[model samples]
Target: MSATVSPDQLPLQRLYHWERTAPNRVAFTQPVGGGQTVDYTWKQVVDQARRMAAHLQAQGIGAGDKVAMLSKNTAHWMMTDYAIWMAGAISVPLYPTLAAGTIRQILEHSEAKLLFVGKLDGWLGMKPGIPEGLPCIHHPLAEADAKKSYPGWDDIVAKTAPLAGEPVRPADDLSTIMYTSGTTGAPKGVMHTFANFMAAVAAGLERIPQNEGSRMLSYLPLSHVVERALVEHGQLQTGMHVYFAESLDTFTTDMQRARPTVFFSVPRLWVKFQQAVNHKMPQKKLDTFLKIPILSGIVKKKILSTLGLDQCIFAAGGAAPMPAELLAWYSKLGLNIAEGYGMTENIGASHITTGDPDSFGTVGRPYAPVQCRIAPDNGEIQVKAPWNMLGYYKQPELSAEMFTDDGWLKTGDKGSTDAQGRLKITGRVKDLFKTSKGKYVAPAPIEDKLVMHNAVEACCVTGANLGQPLALLMINAEATAVVKNGGKAELEASLAEHLKHINETLDPHEQLDCLVITSEAWTVDNDLITPTFKVKRNRIEDMFAKNYDRWVGMRKPVVWHG
Candidate 1:
């Protein structure tokens, strides 16, 4: 609640102040061999960053010049990000797995003159699409020491002198420009300023408090704005120590290593965590045991200790709405993983829960100066925040469309405000559908409901022209096993009975009129799911359009993906 920001300090200046106050305190950690740790102190990070800044500035990089970082979550990645800001360059981040075509386009679009590629995937040739001699730096992930191939990130810093001067950043200077996944079209650069990041930190503090002693893990792509804003920037603000996981495969072991006091994750990861717990203890037995209070405590503690969350204050899920059941399950075990809601335009922390069980479905009230209103047209959420972006990088027309004449950002999301003034987002305005019965249907709530059933892995609820109701589903492997164990005729009969049981609980219109089962998974490789694992409904609907008739007429789940 203290609004005492000094008017003249640049971001680097503020960050340096924290490092000075805690010079010997650990600032970051990364995994090493033999279950050992690789750590960086605050002073070391600041000194190295200054030298890296000197390296970039000596190469003629200056204020507003774009610098792109292409790497995974590692110590070098963070060092390079700080150096970009310390030297007053706008940072552009590229996903390591992205298409070379997309990489080329972003590089050309941002006019990024210097590139840093880390821990290269061997499958993608060393010089696949990159123009030869592009002043590129490469750090193989497996290499323990920075090498001569690309000015081993550390040796270059060790040789250079730290640049020193008064900080010159203004709140309005462009800080970072992150690219969208381009599901709708080619990716456009989304811009943010120093004020955007600072305001986000302020808003986030109001919802979820972090202090100098907070310990966190860094696993998500720093290329993404959410993790960058919450974990990276938050660390700069409070001097919290950050740790990085080895890779996607090592997430479990890495969590055990970090034992983070503060955890943040996307919905996809939240679902996976729940799946992990369920995999260890089957749902039916776990649920039946939870009814007895004393036994439930034993179960909850065992699960929490195993997940390395036995001492966490809060674990948060964001980037997409979470299935409510997941939160309740973890909450029962004394793990409070609250859901947060915000988009890239809002600097990542817009609304979040601060306990109070009744607010489960909502992403909570506004954080700090952020204001929201249910827009008069179709009840889409409208917001105004100091943290809102300057606009899309170089796209004035699209930027103009994003804001109204009066300055509110049209959120493009539909929701309602409860009497308590908390917001509950119902669906995206563009996602609603009209059934043949002349009634409007919101598929999101239905999808959320269907996925809660034990048989479902994930489901897409959509109904167009010919349908009463339709759901495309990927059922759980355990459920599939149950069906296969029974004879064919018996499997069909039992599944039909299950549908009747589920329909009895739904209103006549809400009942699913058709269901299609699929054995195949939707993953990043197939272009069906986002990095955060939300299914692209438009693409899924298009894939199943030819068999719309079968979906509408069926009474039991049908295998469509096979």
Candidate 2:
């Protein structure tokens, strides 16, 4: 990392740089359906943001005021965030899929002065959470009813004069309050300064190396810390051309259009991509093709092209543990997926894999100037970084608990460092469960192995007081459809074989009692998984703990649950 970073490298400062240096360069490309797209030049992006900043200031949103954003990733979503900062306000972003109660909790807790609504699929369900009389500005991509109800972005920009001159914010000023997509409990607002954001991006760029010619596709929820730091701040730093996905149905088209030089996604999406490829070309057939010397290169190229990652120079997976098997699979296909480790607390800069075969399963060395260690007492991973959060907003007691007597942030993840200083996370301290036999098992590792099977989408391994742990598996949509069509016998036989293979690798106590194939899907709507696709263990317990004994006592290797 650079020893001294100029204040000029701050997000707003970088935006100003691009606006002046390359006013005509395309900054954002937005899909508008029907095979059409709209491009926003740097000048256009800055102009709209400037006018919106003036509008926000006119409404008394200045000097640390909190402005909330509720939307999916869109060009205007980034624009609105810039506008909030220009108004001397702290931006608070909400995940677009948040339920009404959680939505209301965050808005009321942050005491947001205003809200920006954009590109939401569930506005009607989420609208009840917004307190009446709170001012809102709608992005053009917002829901139809929301557009009719709130002041539109174009309308406000048209009426307001652009703020003149280069208004500067101090480096230490609060920039954004990112609420965690809580997997266990209520969301906590993670506060970050402008300098924190800049430091994280700088450390990242020191290794990843993006420039003006870099292209990125923004589809991950920008509300997440990884996306906020990598895509939004990365673009601001390097003048990357960002493309937005119009919808899930058109994601492939959007990816082909962007041909992003840099791409990041969670493990679930990576698994889905592999599943899609296997659906088209069975893994057995693909493997056989790759063994032929002449056809190997051609086969790899065709597969990457089909997945729209043929031009991707850097691809990463984070926000959860990526299965080593999955990484090896992509490695064979000529795409090396770097696994990164970070949390909302660290501004998503801690460690990343170095693309070394020796560092395959470990998150490679920590970024420069970031210190990482395992706690002597509980084995929790603790980190001290320039970009660590100020603390959880307005929760002084909880914030105090998040750190040690010194300043290291307690990451809650149990991990160890290798001889080369790479990190290998074992499990969450709180995620370990002791069974009736008094042997504690970390479910994440076992669940990682189970999810490698094609039929499983998401899973949870839990027992608590039972004799042994058991797994609750949610078969993926395609497999579920096949089961509904009466292919249960074959699916059951396949899962039983997979279960036997997995258990053979484990000690008797650590082996699962049974694999219960769940009837219901685990989704955000059902409160069984976070928006980032991490399974909620507590929710899984609430829904299935009552049946643990029955599941284990069934005396079958695989049990089908209704």
What TM-score do all the candidates reach, one by one? Answer: 0.90, 0.98
Give the best candidate by TM-score.
Answer: 2
lDDT for 172 in candidate 1 is 76
Tens-place lDDT digits, model 1, residues 1-562: 1122444334676667866688898888977546667888878888888888898999999998999887778777887888889898998987666667777888888889788877544325334555556676554353432244466665677699997864557777788899866445577788987777876786686666677888888888788788888788888777787888887677778888778888988765666677778877888888987889999889888887888787688789877777676778777777777778888777666788764567788888888788888888689888888878778888899889988888888877899988988889899888888777776777777776666655666678777665466778776666677667865455455555656666777767767776677667766456566655667788887787787776566544544446
Please list the residue runs of candidate 1 whose C-alpha ends up more than 4 Å from where it truly belongs after superposition. 1-10, 120-133, 140-151, 166-168, 454-457, 475-502, 505-507, 553-555
Q: How far in Å is the alpha carbon of 38 misplaced in model 1?
A: 0.8
* TM-score of candidate 2 against the unseen true structure: 0.98
- Badly placed stretches (over 4 Å) of model 2 are 1-4
- The candidate maximizing lDDT is 2
> Relative to the true structure, how large is the alpha-carbon lDDT of every model?
0.74, 0.91
Per-residue alpha-carbon lDDT of candidate 2 for residues 1-562, written as tens digits (9 for 90 to 100): 2223579998899999999999999999998769899999999999999999999999988998999999999999999999999999999999999999999999999999999999998799999999888888899989999999998999899999999988878888999999998889999999999989888899999878588899999999999999999999999999989999988898898889999889999999999998888888988999999999989999999999988999998889999998888899999998998999999999879999966556787888899979998999999999999888888999999899999988898999999988878899999999999989899999888888999998888888899978888999999888988888999899999999999999998888889889998888898888999989999999999988888888788899899888
